[model samples]
Target: MRERVGVYPGTFDPVTNGHLDVIQRAARLLDRLAVGVAINAGKGPVFPLEERVELVRAETAPIAAATGCAISVVPFEGLLVTFAREQGAEMIVRGLRAVSDFDYEYQMAGMNHRLDPGVETVFLTASETNQFISSRFVKEIARLGGDISSFVPQLTLERTLARVRDQAGE
Candidate 1:
């Protein structure tokens, strides 16, 4: 049997619980899952690409072990489909948080399909409890000194708080 590989690409500025939820679910379905940490400069991430990758790698370590799935965290640049192709992933895993996310993801999936017919896009809806968590919101909460412990894992929570404090000179 051919090994099933999938890529879950995201700009995990600070890996959130919601992202981990998607990763956990996706990991169980694929033999090898590549957690693609995208370097999206336009978003002006609080954590650098390397830090983001490290945080994600740390948070996902447990999930990989528990699920017995091979998970690799790789920093990526350029088109997502191109990255997936390079990783030899047959599918792209997407996590949909709400209806708002659908419109954007639908277009992206269609375009990716057009770009490469072989790689399929699969959407996984966020777990009910995590549906409302977004990195943008989590950052806002952290910047305002609000508790974000539930939104992110311990490693991300600590790093994000430290980064926000450092940036604010607090």
Candidate 2:
């Protein structure tokens, strides 16, 4: 087995429980998992790249430790396939929560295959409990002063809400 490695790339402005679920499930399928945090300067991020990376790293540490699968927190600056190739990953894991995301993600997966036929994408359906969880939704809830502690980890919830409040001038 040539080291079953997978790369899960996303913006992950604030890591949510849904993302955690995907990572946990994907980790089981690979010997090493790379969660690539894509930094697109064109689309401004609520949490800076460093802070986002740290939050994801801290939250995923326990899982990585338990699974004995290395979790690398990388900043993706190019095409996702390119990043996956650089990391030596043979699979690109995608988390699908709704049908709406399918069209786009399917297209992306096809494009990735075209780029590197060796790299394949595996889609993991979101658990029913996490079907409604999204970073954008979490941020909106926190922005309105609603508690999102139930949706995300305590540390992440606190930091995300604080960031939202700061951005909203509240």
Model 2, 53-150: lDDT tens digits are 99999999988988888899998898998999999999999999999989999999999999999999999999999998998888878888887987
User: Which sections of candidate 1 miss by over 4 Å?
Assistant: none
* List of clashing residue pairs for candidate 1: none
Give per-residue lDDT, candidate 1, residue 125: 100
Cα lDDT tens digits for candidate 1, 66-137? 998899999999999999999999999999999999999999999999999999999999999999999999
TM per prediction: 0.98, 0.96
Q: After superposition, how far is residue 109 of candidate 1 from its true place, in Å?
A: 0.2
- C-alpha lDDT of candidate 2 relative to the true structure: 0.90
lDDT of each: 0.95, 0.90
Clashes of 1: 0
Q: Pick the candidate with the highest TM-score.
A: 1
Q: Report the CA-based lDDT of candidate 1 relative to the real structure.
A: 0.95
